[model samples]
Target: MKTLGQKIRERREELDLSLREFAKKLNCSPPFISDVEHGRRFPSEPMLEEMARLLKLDVAEIKRHDQRAPLDEIKRMTEQDPGYAFAFRTLVDKKLTPEQLLELVNRSKPSPKGGKK
Candidate 1:
């Protein structure tokens, strides 16, 4: 499980892009990019998308290492329906294993795309 910084730095080096060059392409400062690479900070969603495109990596791959809570989204969901809040509380109280969580998600309704469950 490589950290986002490790993945980005490795891919950037593999593509022979210098820090300044990568930053220039991303329209961000080199220092900010350095901070992200050193794990001092995480890139925003839009920035992560751009990095994924440039590095030929999936956005989800980078996002898995984000370490930031999706607090805004969670708050919105909980406000929209109390069920979401209850579900979250239950999950925290039970301290469900990651594997259990994935299994639970897998048992949910199929996607709109009609993909297999």
Candidate 2:
């Protein structure tokens, strides 16, 4: 579970690019890049895309390290259906593991005409 900064730094180093050189190529300041590598900041979506290209890494790999919660989506879901909020609370109360939760979701999905898909 490497942080985005850690992944970026490692990939950049593997490419033999200095911090300053990488920053120059990204059209950002070296200190800004340093802050990102130190986990004090995150790059914008466009910058992340360029970074992925420069490092020859997948955009999904960079996004996977984004730790920000989808707060807006969560709020919208809870507001649209209070049942969602209750379900979320129940999940927290039951302390269900991720695997168990995924299993529950899979079981709840509609089956095919004669059997499960």
Candidate 3:
């Protein structure tokens, strides 16, 4: 699996940008760009957004390249539970964006532990 850095580097190359050129566009040093390409550093959210704009990347594409754990965990849960399986299927059917799902989850109140409240 390619790391986030590799993915960024690939996109940069696809745009035919040299390290110096890309760094200049991003307003960072070449070394910082190199470290980010080599996985020695994580990019900031603002940087990520700039990259997304430059690379024509959407939120889903970026998340897929950077974070797979949430999807993997859901896959595991679906395999172990029929309810989860159904819910996963429903989510796919609805084509809900990750941001929308996150909003829904954030808005929900967690149930009280042990049914005490």
Candidate 4:
């Protein structure tokens, strides 16, 4: 798996874009762009959006390369929120399919009178 910066750098290189040129498109300093491409910094949401547009790539592709929070942080969040913990535990325990998960999500939605929505 490539780092986010590596992905960004690779895309830029593929398009034959110089660092300065890419920075101009993103409205950021070249040094900042360099940092981002070297894994010393990450782009903000707006920057990521602009990068996706300029690179002609899906935003999801860029987002997919983003580093997730550490496991300890995830554990902390799960422990802090009882409802979230329960839902997550239930999901793990039941190993629900995508359709089943969708059903559970939709089940929480309010229906109009006569139980129709």
Candidate 5:
């Protein structure tokens, strides 16, 4: 799993941006950008939204990488309910490997007998 800093660095590089240049564009100090890229500091939500715009990444991608569930808690959850774990793992694996599920989800429409639209 890539860290938020790693993702930020990668995106910055992909855009051919120097740290100073990126910082200038973000209207923040270079040291702040450095801290964020080195994982010494986390960006605020508004800062993250700015990064998403400048880097052309979805805000959710940055947020997800930045905030992660602790591994120990995840392990405990899986241990407490193996069936839930299995189902979750299966869904994630399918999500990664196939487009069918994604397409189905994206293409889903309101049912004629719907309770909610």
Candidate 6:
């Protein structure tokens, strides 16, 4: 879960641009860029848009952090899989181990053919 500031900094570093150099391109002060990178300030919408263009990053990627839903529902669904349910009851329920669950998932992977995996 990267913050917007971290995303901006990553993009800047990926381009190998110094803060001053990047600021020169953005027509802003290096202090302002530093502030944004340090999370002391947030860029305006227009500023974000411009930065996205300059940095070659997706605006949404820069703006949002990655998040995941809780795994409770997924766990319940996995419990219902007949192929895995026995293993889950016999091993996972008894020992609360995840080895069998991982093996079951690994077995389900499709073999790679011509296409990339």
The residue ranges of model 2 lying beyond 4 angstroms of the native Cα positions read 96-117
Off by over 4 Å in 3: 67-117
lDDT (10s digit) by residue, model 3, range 1-117:
577888888988998889899898899999998998887787787987887787787855765666424677877887888898888789889999978998877877666763222
TM-score of 3: 0.55
User: Which whole-number lDDT from 0 to 100 does residue 70 have in model 1?
Assistant: 86
What is the C-alpha lDDT profile of model 1 across 1-117, one tens digit per residue?
Answer: 677888899899999999999999999999999999999988888999999999898998878767667899999999999999999999999999977988988788687897655
In model 3, the number of clashes is 0
Better of 2 and 5 by TM-score: 2
- lDDT: worst 10-residue window of model 1: 108-117
Give the Cα lDDT of each candidate. 0.90, 0.91, 0.80, 0.85, 0.84, 0.76
What TM-score does prediction 5 earn?
Answer: 0.58
Top candidate when judged by TM-score against the true structure: 2
Quote the lDDT for 99 in model 1: 77
Q: Which candidate is the best by lDDT?
A: 2
User: What TM-score should be assigned to candidate 2?
Assistant: 0.76
Runs in model 1 lying further than 4 Å from the true structure = 110-117
lDDT (Cα, tens digit) per residue for candidate 2, span 9-87: 9999999999999999999999999999889988999999999999999999888877767889999999999998999
lDDT of 5 by residue, 1-117 (tens): 578988999999999999999999999999999999889998888999999899999998887677445678878888998986997688877766435665766676767895335
Ranking by lDDT: 2, 1, 4, 5, 3, 6
Candidate 6 lDDT tens digits, 1-117: 576777888889999989999999999999999998877887888998899999998888776642333378658877777755575467645664346556766667665763324
How much does each candidate deviate from the true structure in C-alpha RMSD? 3.6, 3.7, 8.9, 5.8, 6.2, 9.9
lDDT of 5 at 38: 89
Q: Which prediction has more favorable TM-score, 3 or 4?
A: 4
Which RMSD does model 2 reach against the true structure?
A: 3.7
Clashing pairs in 5: none
